[model samples]
Target: MYVVIFRARIRQLDEDYRRSAERLRELALGRYGCLAFHALSEGEEEIALSYWPDEAAIRAWNNDPEHRQAQQLGRERWYAWHRVEVAQIERAYGAAP
Candidate 1:
C-alpha cells in the first residue's frame, strides 16, 4: 500500500475550495484507486492522508488534470504553505470500530 500525506497552513477556504476538495476526494476514490482518505484541521493547519494500492495509483492521481488544477488553486489561494509526502506501507493494523 501507499500513502500520501499533505500538511498545509491555510490561507483561505471559501465555498469553491470546499466544493473542489469534495470533488477531488470523489475523483480519487472513484477513478484513481484510492483506498481511503482522511483529513483534519486545527486552527490554520490541515492534514490530509490518502491511501492507495501502490505507487502507480498515487502517481496517476497526482498527475490528474483536475487534481493539478486544485493544487494550483491551493498554492495561489487556499494555502499559505504545504508539504506532501508519499510512503509505502509495510504493514497496518487497527481495531474494529
Candidate 2:
C-alpha cells in the first residue's frame, strides 16, 4: 500500500469546492483504485490522506482530467498553498474490537 499526504493552507471554501471534493473522492475510489481516503480541516489548514495500491494508480489519478481541473481551481480559488507527498507503507498495525 501507498499513501498520498496532501496538506493545504486554505484560502476559501464554497459550495463548488464541497461538491467538487465529494465528486473527486467518489471518482478516485470508484475508478482509480483508491483504497481509502480521509480529510480534515482546522482553521485555515487542511490535510488529506488517501491510500492507493501502487504508484501506477496514483499516477493515473494524478493525470485524470477532472482532477486536473480541480487542481487548477484549487490553485486559482480554494487554496493559498498546498503540498503533496507520496510514500510507500512499510507496515501497518491496528487494534480491533
Candidate 3:
C-alpha cells in the first residue's frame, strides 16, 4: 500500500476552500480508489493522510485537474507553507474497536 502525507501551515480558509476540500475528498474516495483519508487541523497547522492500493492510484489522484487546481489555490491563498511525502507501508497492525 501507498500513503501520502500532507502537512501545511494554514493562511486562511473560506467557503470556497471548504467546498473544494470536500469535493476533492469525495473524488478521491469515489473515483480514484483512495483506500482511506484522514485530516486534522490544529491552530495554524493542518495535516492530511491518504492511503491508496498502489503508486498508480496515488499518481492519478495527484495529477487530477481538480486536485491540481486546489493545489494552486492553496499556494496562492490557503497555505503559508506545505510539504508532501509519499511512502510505502511495509507493515500495519491494529485492533478494531
Candidate 4:
C-alpha cells in the first residue's frame, strides 16, 4: 500500500474551494483505484490523505488533468504553502474490543 499526504497552509477557503474539493474526491473515488481518502482542515491548516494499492495507481491519479488544475488553483489562490509526501505503508492494524 502507499499513502500520499498533502499538508497545506490555507490562505482562504471559499465556497468554490469546498465545491472543488468535493468534485475532486468524487472523481478520484469514481475513476481511480483510490482505496481511501480523507481531508482535514483546521483554521488555516489542511491535510489530505489518499491511499492507493501501489505506485502505479498513485502515478495515474497524479497525472489526472482535473487534479492538475486543482493543484494550480491551490498554489495560486487557496494555499499559502504546502508539502507533499509519498510514503510506503508498511503495515496496518485494527482491533475491536
Candidate 5:
C-alpha cells in the first residue's frame, strides 16, 4: 500500500478555496484504485492524506491533467507553500470502534 501526504500554507483561505479543494478531492477519491482520502485545515495550514493500492495508481493520479491543473492553481492562487510526501505502508493495524 502507498500513502500520500500533502501539507500546505494557504494564501486565500476562503469559501472558494474550500470548494475547489473539495472538488479536487472528490475527483481523486472517486478514481479507480483509491482506497481512501482525508483532508483538514487549521489556522493557515491545510493537510490532506490519501491511500492507494500501489505505485502505479499514485503515479497516474499525480499525472492526471485535472490534478495537474489543480496543483498549478494551488501554487498560483491558493497556497503560499506546500510539501508532499509518499511512503509505503508495510503494515497497518486497526479496527472499527
Candidate 6:
C-alpha cells in the first residue's frame, strides 16, 4: 500500500469547497482505486491522508479532469499553500479497541 499525504494552509473555505471536496473523495474512492481516505482541519491548517494500491492509481487520479479542475480551484481560491507527499508502506501493525 502507498499513502498520499496532503497538507495545506487554508485561505478560505466555502460551500463550493465543501461540495467539491465531498465529490472528489467519492470520485477517488469509487473510480481511482483509493483504498481509504481521511482528513481533518484545525484552525487554518488541513491534512488529508489517502491510501492507494500503487503509483499508477495515484497518477491516474492526479490526471483526472475533475480533479485537475479542483486543483486549479484550490490554487486560486481555497488554499494559501499546500504540499503533497507520496510514500510506500513498508510494514503494518495496528490495534483496534
Candidate lDDT values, in order: 0.95, 0.98, 0.97, 0.91, 0.86, 0.98
Greater lDDT among 1 and 3 belongs to: 3
The per-candidate count of clashes, in order, stands at 0, 0, 0, 0, 0, 0
List model 3 lDDT by residue over 20-62, tens digit each: 9999999999999999999999999999999999999999999
Give the per-residue lDDT of model 4 (tens digit) for 2-37: 999999999988998899999989888888888889
Encode model 2's per-residue lDDT on 1-97: one tens digit a residue: 9999999999999999999999999999999999999999999999999999999999999999999999999999999999999999998999932
Model with the higher lDDT, candidate 2 or 4: 2
* Model 2 ranges with Cα > 4 A deviation: none
Candidate 2 lDDT score at position 71: 100
Q: Who is ahead in lDDT, 1 or 2?
A: 2
Report the C-alpha displacement of residue 55, candidate 2, in angstroms: 0.2
Candidate 5 on 1-97: residue-level lDDT in tens? 9999999998886676678777777777787567898888899999989999999999998898878888888899999999999999997888942
Ranking by lDDT: 2, 6, 3, 1, 4, 5
After TM-score superposition, the amount by which residue 92's alpha carbon in candidate 3 deviates from its true location, in angstroms, is 0.5
| Candidate 4 structure, TM-score to reference | 0.94
| Model 5, position 67: C-alpha lDDT score | 82
Stretches of candidate 6 exceeding 4 Å from the true structure: none
TM per prediction: 0.96, 0.97, 0.97, 0.94, 0.88, 0.97
* Sequence-dependent TM-score of model 1: 0.96
Model 6: what TM-score?
Answer: 0.97
